[model samples]
Target: MKSPSIAKQLKRDRAFVLMFAPVLLYFILFKYVPMFGIVISFMDYNLFKGITGSEWVGFKYYAQFFENRDAFVIIKNTVLLGAYKLLFGFPAPIVLALLLNELRHAIFKRFVQTVSYLPHFLSNVVVASMLIMLLSPSTGWVNRIIEGLGFPAISFLQESEWFRSIYVLSEIWQQVGWGSILYLAAITTIDPQLYEAARMDGAGRWKQTLHVTLPGIAATVVIMFILQIGHALEIGFEKVFLLSNAATYDTSDVIATYVYRVGILQGGFSYATAIDLFMGVIGFLLVYATNQLSRRLGETSLW
Candidate 1:
């Protein structure tokens, strides 16, 4: 009887199950199946011999990665890059959404939104190329403008100090508008009567926004914050790899880029895997800590 009832309930929800089938299949194929390969991190892995035939060298690769002279440099770059993006990039979208919410003219708002969101659709290769061109000390428009203003020409991409700034700004430019969409949607779901009451109580635009709008969107902000924490170390490989050169390696080489160099380029598969696995563990701990903090603050969390 219980089995039949459960089957009937599932039959009623068959459409929902069918809708989720592709997503489940995708995770299984790309995520779960690949996770099985992580075991190679503990072995002296070789592509020629494959996983099973590779020598069992438990923890050696992990030990080598920690003891490597570049370990601190790589970790520093990863933390600083990720921290800068989180501190600056995460807030830009929320601010943009708030500003867009205040726009009275629908036409103006739509135009601004379309222009802003366009960058998110662009490929990282294109973005990096554009940045390189724009920041070129000799021929770039930015340099020309600086020269016109009687300032010395600056090579932004070559300077290690400029790498994090350029990386963070490019990220903000690409994703700010797209990221704001969720906050804007959340803002719309707030009660209209609350705003009306605030207005009646002699609240001005700033007051209304601070009191009504900000609080209304706080939950969404917290959840996004938690998600950001989860990926704190996982900056996009394509953008950084393309933008970076040997000159900027001090500030620009993150764990992902290091993994690429040692793994794909140098063919140190096992050691790279160990570093990658370490990154994943640290990232998970950060996410867990953030979620716990958010919960304690009585805000929304991914958990």
Candidate 2:
């Protein structure tokens, strides 16, 4: 059969198109429009002069970033922190969703989900404060327990070595539950008959999950994974800023915090813009590479 004409299709889906108009406008306004500001990376940007009047000094700021002595350290810290987050945070929601899906008790499952999702609604500042209080070297429950066990009280926030682990764990705590919402929704899309077939074959819950559930949601999982890789470097600034200090700078200093210091605080606009542009390019490449790899490996990907 011949496909309907564009006009006919639009007429048939008019209500749906009306509903989608605001979303399209939002991306065009906030997301795409702001990207045009990236041109500042190539110029000596000035508040007084603005974009059009700013002097063009192409690649100067980029070269300066590479020449700086602390460049390597900051890059290494950003990469390691991003890698650890991806390694740990990526699978957490998948595991939680699967566990929750297996529950036979509706009330209990909902209660557990509600408790898990509440943390994601908390402000970053509040989360950071909670972590600091809980891990305080003095007058904190954790340290008190350590002392009771005949060990010296350790300051987790002050130590560079513990920063990555602490950050990853806290991130998982805040995000895992809310993140699982997508996977849970995907789980509902699987054919119920598939589960019946698995049971007919004498498969247990574990076997059904392995053979039926995982494969059913594999496409959603791959898409989410690729999107996660795209933002691996774009760590939120609020939590890191509140948690980090001079003592933890060696391990906790990420690109976002550094950008806040040099760009927003110190007013080195062009230099900071250059660094951020580099990060954006890296993230874009990550998404592209991962998408290509996924397609090659017979998995779904973001186009």
Candidate 3:
């Protein structure tokens, strides 16, 4: 039989199309449309002159950024923060999903999931305030415990050494449950007979999880990992900005906050745009490389 015409197919799937229309419009309006501003990175970007009227100065801002004294430090801080978050945060959801899968008590499992997921919905501002209150060297619970052990209270937010750790841990705590939702959904798609067969062969829970559950969700994990790698350099601005102070700038300053300071605050639009565009290109390259590597090593890839 001949395939339905385009119009007929659209009519048949009208409900699905209606559901997706808003998302498509959103990306066009917020994501893709604004990409045109990238050209400002190569221009002087006068506020009144605008894109067409601005003087073109190709590579000048990029060169200046690279030549700056603080460039290396800024880049290093961004990379290390991204790497640490990826290293710790990537596995957290997977571990949570596996543990949750083993739980037979529905009420307790849902309670744990609900508690873990609640932090993800909190605004960055609130989370930052909570962190400050919880880690205060003077009256914070964390420091209280430390003092209880006869050790001196440590100012976690003020210290440069603790910035990355604090950021990573907070991210994991906020996102682990929400992230695990995908893995849990993937686990449900696995055939039950596989688990039953494993049981028939005297395979324990751990063995079933290792051999069956993990492999079942391996594709989802790979896709998620690849997507995470794509955003390795694109850390969110609000939480880091709210959490960081001058004392912690050495470790906490990242590309997003740097762009905000330079582009929005200092009015070096071209210079800041150049830095952002450069990082975006690097992120794209990382995603491409990771996807290519995944394709070669396994059946899973973003493509």
Return the candidate ranking by lDDT, descending: 1, 3, 2
- Prediction 3 TM-score vs. true: 0.85
Whole-model lDDT, candidate 1?
0.93
RMSD to the true structure for each prediction, in A, is: 3.2, 4.3, 3.9
Candidate 2 total steric clashes: 0
Task: Write down the TM-score of every candidate.
Answer: 0.88, 0.82, 0.85
**Which of the predicted structures, 1 or 3, would earn the higher TM-score when compared with the native?**
1
Give the range where candidate 1 is weakest over 10 consecutive residues by summed lDDT. 1-10
Over the stretch 153-272, how does candidate 1's per-residue lDDT look in tens digits?
A: 999999999999999999999999999999999999999999999999999999999999999999888878877877788888999999999999988999999999999999999999
Clashing pairs in 3: none
User: Number of clashing residue pairs in every model?
Assistant: 0, 0, 0
lDDT of 2 by residue, 1-303 (tens): 999999999999999999999999999999998799889989999999999999999999999999997678788989998889999999999999999999999999999999999999999989999999999999789899999999999999999999999999999999999999999999999999999999999999999999999999998898788778877887888988999998999988888888889999999999998998898899889878877877776756666
State the weakest 10-residue window (summed lDDT) of model 2.
294-303
Query: How would you encode candidate 3's per-residue C-alpha lDDT over 144-259 as one tens digit per residue?
Result: 99999999999999999999899999999899999999999999999999999999999998899999999999988887887788778878999999999888888888889999
* Model 1 error, position 87 (Å): 0.6
Question: What local lDDT does model 2 show for residue 79?
Answer: 90
